[model samples]
Target: MAEQQTDFDVLIVGAGLSGIGMAAHLTEKCPGRSYAILERRGNLGGTWDLFRYPGVRSDSDMHTLGFDFEPWRHEKSIADAPAILDYLHRIVADRDIGPNIRFGHKVISADFDMANARWDIVAETEDGERKRLSASWLYLGSGYYDYDEPYDPGFATERFEGQIVHPQFWPEDLDHAGKKVVVIGSGATAVTVVPAMAARAAKVTMLQRTPTWMFARPAKDSIANFLRRMLPEQTAYRITRWKNMKLQSLAFKRARTKPQKMGEALHKRIEKVLGENFDAEAFTPPYDPWDQRLCLVPDNDLFEAINEGRAEIVTARIEAFEKDGVLLSNGRFLPADIIVTATGLKLCVAGKIAVSVDGEPVDFAQRFYYKGCMFSNLPNLAVVFGYLNASWTLRADLNSDYVCRVLNHMARTGADMAVPVLPHGHGLEEDDIFDFSSGYIQRSKHLMPKNATRYPWRLNQEYLVDRKRMASEPITDGILEFSRARQDQGAAPEMAAAE
Candidate 1:
């Protein structure tokens, strides 16, 4: 193999929210440092750019999703996909960050060179050409969603006759109007698809293996709009962001502390709005609220669609797909002209790229998560993963800030590499990280971090705790070690223990 060459101080994969955030932070904090961001798709905005399904909107409030330095000026609190993509584009163009981003480049593998104390990254282009680049630091922000493929059931390809489509890979040419549609799965995507398709399609049926707890909220806030006009953008943004944070935190606390009472109150609210004829069991989730993400239905649109007779909910396991539609395990066959498999996504850690250290592949499955960023044995490589309970950007922002601190610390101390070293006999066990039985999460259990009932590994969704740990706390929490390289040889372990 011929050696291809490129170099950078920092190499970031995926130009989505986290990738862009990482680039912005690095450029601002470490000026004159050569860095590049690689994006697989032709455009940016990872999830927003990929999913083009009808009525696509964020599950979280826009205030929290928006960048801290950049205020989201949308009229709606829960923004549509296009709006979010536009915001990202504006940020990229305004900051002149586009130059640093190399679109249509997909990273295949990354190997850490122990002797040189650098990472060699191999990326393939859309046309099948491959190139290799070296960088001192490598950051993975590829996100969780799989871009090219859908998670269809094994029997789907041969059995289903109707046009089957996944929300993530929705074809632009396929038309859903005037047809009977059946959307599989019960989550944010399924809830969003049913109502939107119902408007144009003859009828839309949402097939769920299990019921999800649905909550109704306005897409736009009158108070937020008022404040935007009355107060400065920064002030309004901060106020709304913090206010939503507090409300969400309070809700989570109430749900956990007084689960029975909170569940009853929520059940009553759903019954009152959905009416006497509504099947309460279909709308109520079996598990406690927040155990899985609470499904947000904008303006009661899904329920309204159901009430209007354009949409219906079927809470049953899909036994298999038939020639015309899906067959339920109970022997009922629902006919559909089109099938939308909103059946969740595949969680790909670090975009499923092979990560190696010193020419040896590192087993992330055996590693413990340090501050949810650094892996136990991986050196000079940090991953940005967000909170499962709060807005993803909240945790990602903290990770970016901390990475900057790490970079500054490295440069100031003349260190070539810094990797988190877990104490001896420390290993994550199964049944501790994710307790959910959801197929997407359960299948990827080995690639994810286990949340112990302790600190760090146990993910605390509270922003205050994350803020104190990432920004205020010392880096030398006894888990990470930094080493410097001399002119004659490679990185030598210098013990300036993190205080």
Candidate 2:
């Protein structure tokens, strides 16, 4: 194995929305800092590029999903994968961040050397060549889900003779025209795929063990468009973004505080769409709204498909897969030429990259999340985990800005190392970072970092609250300790401060 060494002031992993946004922030806020982005894939646009499934689109509006610095100029707020990719491409091209990207460099592990106050990283290329690099700060923009392998529900595939497909790894050549398609699962993917496949397929059916709350809204935001026409692009974008954030926060609070009313309201909206044909029980979930994310159907496309007799929803447990279709627990058989598994994702911590401090492997589940970005007792490392209730980019933008602030503070204070130190015996009540009841969240909670009940110690779900705290909170909080390393002896600490 060949080896190479390189150094940068900061290193960003995964050139997805988070990674690209962080780099753009660096250019704007920390121009003097040297940085590079390492992407395991050959191309950019992480999730947007990876999931090629039919009707893959953002459930969240693009106004908030877009970067704080960049304005979303698209007509459709709920954008498809290609539109999202185009937005990302524009950012990369306009900001000139393309040259700094190192594609096909998959990060295997990162070790923080406390003595030197830097991170030693090991990354492997596509050809199995190992390369070594060092950076003062490591930012993990890699998403929380496992990219190599998706979650499997363990279906009996041998009994089914027809074609089966997983949305995560959708085959480009598979044809569904004039075929009967049965999609399993009731989340966002299933809702999106059923309607999309129904366009060409003879019939499409969504099979779910339980129902999910659904909300129908126009894909194009008239208010946003009107604002854009009346005001300048940036002004319009800012106004719309702030408006959406407030609405999102209010809706989330209402769902938590008064789930019954919110759930009723959502059902009523769907009832209006389906009218006499509405299946009240099939549209209602046992749990409250926002327990799992509420699926958004743009322009009532899913409901429209159902009303047109092109697509239908079947709520039942799967007994097994037969030769031609799915066998329901109720002994009902659904004929299908193609079966699509829209199962949830398999979540992983820090892109499955092994991280250690002073050669000791770090168990994230045992560590507390610091300020929603960095971890307790971990130096010069930050991870971007987005919000559960709001647009993911909302949290991503805040985290990127917070990281830039930290880096700038270090330069101004001449500190070579910074870590959020949770002293022993500190009585911070531990809390769950994610309060979601979704299968993906429930399945992967064990792999997540610890969260505290207080501010600056938890991954907060409130976007507006987080936005203010991340921007205004003092970076020199006593919990985060900063220190300088001695030049004479690499092992000697010259000075340490927790100002």
Candidate 3:
């Protein structure tokens, strides 16, 4: 069969926030260069569109979550999913981004055409037809999460008699009104589900395998709201955005640097809210705070739901699922008409795309990360990783700006490729990057990036430091090497290998 082929200057996989951001920057910085964003879903806003479970809101403030050029006009600092989706849609339309987006095209594999200095991307359409495309550059902004897989236990779906659902794959028609609902997992998804489910479900029980350090914060600040009304929207947004950004950054820094003090303060605040019903032992996380993602409750709504008897918290190991519900390790069975597995998402590094340079596969396990952007030996590609501590967009935006600078520098210098090349003996070790044993990061440790020392590998989550390093630094940093494409002409290989 003949393969259908299309050509572009750049081919972007996943039309999510990052991909859209990339498109916006590319169009603005390097015009007349063709680029196309291929999305698996029929719409934009990746996770926002994919996840429909109730109480979906940005855990981070919307001001920081939104693109810097675009101001988030929502009344609430922490806006819900629908509003976010709308914001992304508006950006897509207003920026003329839709023309560059091809919906229902899922990237199956991307292979580097060594001889041609290009990428051969293979994708499957919604209709099950396969197509091939080539691009000078391939940008993978797919985000980490796997779209199809649910992280429930081995026997989760088979053993559970009740309707089992994963929030990532939530069914719009699934009924929960007046039915007893059991939400599994203790991350952001579970925190959001419990409160939303409690409103309509007869009772919502949060079943956790382990405890998460959760804190209550208002979604809408009274002072910010008053200022928004009194001051201009843009001015108010700038002030609130910077104010929240600094405050959150400081809080996270304190939590990481002086954990005991900050943890104690957070614990005390949580205890005050829970009052006599608080189970300190059950609620306190085993690891230090921020080791795992912290759970955020907007305006203490989750606690309110629990105190109102609409929700209940259960901390126990699930031995198995019974005919009607979940059986705990202690042999106690909790009846439930519906079960929502808010288990974490599977992280797909570089959208599981195989990366290679000159017929050699780039072994990410051995390669060290340079400034948390480019990896050693992989030319012309940089992965944008966000802050583990604050809003993801804050770091992503900086990375995007840095990418533009690098690309602009390359164009001006006549360099065809740029890759991070750390000094010999400077490689990251596994232990330095992550110490936790939970979620996808733990499961995919071997595949993820790590830091060996304080510089590039250390992953300094501080915005001030990152801002100086990423934004203000020269594009031609010594660590990052730029080179022109090889002039050697050769035929294409029979089969491209995976990384």
Candidate 4:
């Protein structure tokens, strides 16, 4: 049993949204392969399990966010945390994925031994047990944010008498009822929490150093429900997903071309709904559209909260935390019983797990990402990075499918190891992967991978573009180096056996 414990054809690193979707794909597409998903937490949901703050919800539409094979039956395009978690749980139960998941296994390192053509994975269990697992392939499905350590604003929490809270670790027992709440940051998370907390709180204020782009979209998709009644469940979902995907793609392109126009349009839309009471001066941002992600408020809920006198938006910088509340740089002090720091997430590369190829440490900062999924020079490893302009699961599905395609190609060719080699950098300069100017991205740009100026080297952020390329792109484009099994174990299973 001990010897058998370490063996698997593939090892998945997280049981989050991407991990679960990948597992389902592998089960359907590669039935012969043995795989296991190791989640560091006791619960299956990664981000959903970690963040329990009020008004926690998905900014992207659920039609595109849901798994390709599974159709989301819900009406709301923007779903709350509990509904999203329930969807994940339902997928697991329906697929019988519970048996394949090993909860509480925090992976420490994965070292690839070239001679054996296998990876030795070291993981520590929650109860302090160390286990070694061996596999031919590794998949990183853990989302980018670090659960153990959230981004700290470096504010003086000690001086403040009010309850200072970070959205990542929301205290369940904290009494926030009827208190004056001041939330810092203008990102999606802050916008979401403001309206939800404002429903009960006496007053909620959103304080941001710089205002982010905010737009209001309908919470429910009436067209989707209408199509669902007329068409089959799977058919309706696919059609709606594609429709949303294309619209999102078009919007990004137009925003890039006509930033000023797009920005003005968004501002006008918000102002029209907000009426005479709206603060157009505060809502207008300095940067152009799509420079950073836009904050989405469902059904003008945030605007309604502001107009109804339950919430207010303040654009200002924080000087320091006073005894009672935050002192602004503009010589204004906002008194609050509760101060919520919804600043942003701390970006992490591949979940911050240590990885080494042979004996040399893998420096992600110096590496080039191949096809936006695997790092150049890495063998049998794939990472799922979602699009910033659209739903994350769209990219996850395509990445998983690409992995299956590569694995099947190797099986057909009787090759056991495949590595992507960068072509001497082609004298092409390295550029940043993400084009956004968000604070979290700017803070962690040094630790992330770079993209090249060439195709398959430069990552595509467009969903439709990636869909076509990832599906039809040649797997062996003279870049990936494939090898047979090490001589000691056996010759790569005979070509005839693969058939």
Reference-based TM-score of each model: 0.93, 0.97, 0.91, 0.95
Where does model 1 exceed 4 Å of error?
1-5, 156-159, 426-431, 435-437, 450-453, 457-459, 486-499
- Whose lDDT is higher: candidate 1's or candidate 2's? 2
Clashes in candidate 3: how many? 1
Among all candidates shown, the one with the greatest TM-score: 2
Count: clashes, candidate 4: 0
Which digits, one per residue and each the tens of the lDDT, describe model 3 over residues 1-499?
A: 1223388877878787788888888877777668899999998998788888888888888888888767787778778989999899888888788888888998887766555667777789999998888887777788876787856456555766679888887888988999999998888899999999899999999998888888788887766787788898788777877888888878876777887887788788877887887787767877888777678888888888888999989999988887789889988788999988887878767777666655566566766666777666566666666776778778667766777778778778876666666555443454456544467677777777656556765455677688777766787768677665555423422221112
Q: State, as a TM-score between 0 and 1, how close model 2 is to the true structure.
A: 0.97
lDDT of 4 by residue, 402-481 (tens): 88888888889888788777655257566667898888889998988878767677666878988898888789889777
**How big is the RMSD of model 3?**
3.6
Query: How far out, in Å, is residue 372 in model 3?
Result: 1.7
Which stretch of 10 consecutive residues in model 2 shows the poorest summed lDDT?
490-499
For candidate 4, give the lDDT: 0.86
lDDT of 1 by residue, 1-499 (tens): 1123379889999998999988888778888678889899999999888888999989999898887878889999888999999899988888778888888889999998766778999999999999889899999889876676667566555676779888887899988889999998889999999999999999999998889877888899777898999999899988988898888888878887887777777777667667864797787777888777788888888888888999999988878788888889999889998988888887867887888876677666766667777766677888877766788888778888888888888888887878876555455442366545567777788777555466665555677678877777787677667775444363454322121
Would you list the C-alpha lDDT of every candidate in the order shown? 0.81, 0.90, 0.77, 0.86
| Candidate 2: tens digits of C-alpha lDDT, residues 1-499 | 1123379999999999999999999999999998899999999999999999889999999999998899999999999999999999999999889988999999999998877788999999999999999999999999989998989999887888889999989999999999999999999999999999999999999999999999999999999999999999999999999999888889999999999999889989999999987998899998999998999999999999999999999999999888999999999999999999998899999989999977888888888888789988788999999998988888889989998998999999999888888767778898877898999999999998988899887899888888888878899988788887545345653222111
The alpha-carbon deviation from the true structure for residue 135 of candidate 2, after best TM-score superposition, in angstroms, is: 0.6
Candidate 2 — which pairs collide?
Answer: none
Q: What does the lDDT read for residue 362 in candidate 3?
A: 57
**Candidate 2 Cα errors over 4 Å, as ranges:** 1-5, 486-499
- In candidate 4, position 304 carries an lDDT of 95
